[model samples]
Target: MSQSDAARWEARYQAGTAAYAAQPSAFVLDWLPRLPRGRALDVACGLGATAIALAEAGFDVTAVDIAPTALARARTEAERRGVTVDWQCADLSDLRLPPAQYDLIVNIHYVNRDLTAQFAEALRPGGHVLFEQHLRWPTPVDGPGSDHFRLRPGELRHLLWQLDILHYAEGPFDGRDGERLALARAVGLKHH
Candidate 1:
């Protein structure tokens, strides 16, 4: 993406840090106990919820998002929580991370199907990726209006074909602001 993409997200995030939940997704909290502590990456980590949580859990963390405002807020919150996170601002919509550089990768409530292949490639052996995103459904919800932005049925499973899926679920979910969203959540482990 170009500077236009950053400007667009910057405009959205100008609305303030309340754009998403203040806490990490339930999926992240649930799987924290199962994941190994190591260097981690949080792609499009708006407001730093997941990134902060990972840091608090002792993972050397790097978080990236397009909006500087959001990253600012996230940095503040992470500091308030007394956790260290390397917050970076970038347009990861066309994300490409270093190969086998992280032990864990996290993506919450964001989609970049184009990045799935690189997701697995970015993880070291025995590493994991915890992902959750809105899915196409017949109901109005709190996510992208376009089907292209949401995962199709069974798409999450297929996207992580290079890894072993440790957990997966897709259905109506309670999201921020009591919105009923069809979400797909998955935990995939890379086994070399």
Candidate 2:
């Protein structure tokens, strides 16, 4: 992530009274009942919502983000919720995830296409990855308009093709902010 991009996210998190909801992503919640309690990683864990949920579910959770401001808020929330999460501040664009370290990985509303391979490598064998992100829509909504930040149609499936897909969905959906968005959601299991 660029310094400017990080600054932008910091500003957003700092300005809003509640930049993001305290609840976990819908996709995460949907799969939570089926996931094993184990070491989990939440990438770009803005506000640490999903991370907090994972911790509460008895998973040892680590949440990473580029913005220090966001991570700070996440830490405060985790403390308030009475759950421990390892909050890490790092730019995923350059950070190398540890190999075979996580049993479950949750990535929501963040797009780092370059990290797909690393995400697979970071998961232990038979581990699962739950990912959801905004897609390039016909008309711009409240998302980064660039193709670089948005996934193309069917792009995510192709990206994680090596893994066994447990579930996949793509289409317009209502966002937390009540805005309409084209999104892609998926769950992939690493081969054992």
Residue 35 in candidate 1, Cα distance off native in Å? 1.0
Q: List the candidates' TM-scores in order.
A: 0.93, 0.93
Q: Which clashing pairs does model 2 show?
A: none
lDDT, candidates in the order shown: 0.87, 0.87
Clashes found in each candidate (C-alpha, N, C closer than 3 A): 0, 0
In model 2, which runs have C-alpha deviations exceeding 4 angstroms? 139-142
Candidate 1, 3-90: lDDT as tens digits: 8867877887786645565678778988999888999999988888989989999999999998888899899998888989999987
Give the deviation of candidate 1 from the true structure as CA RMSD. Answer: 1.6
Worst 10 residues of 1 by lDDT: 15-24
RMSD of 2: 1.6
lDDT of 2 by residue, 1-192 (tens): 899988888888888744554568878987999988899999999888889999998999999998788788889988998999999999888988889999998888888877877888999998999999888888767666677778999998998887899999998888777978789999999999
How high a TM-score does candidate 1 get?
A: 0.93
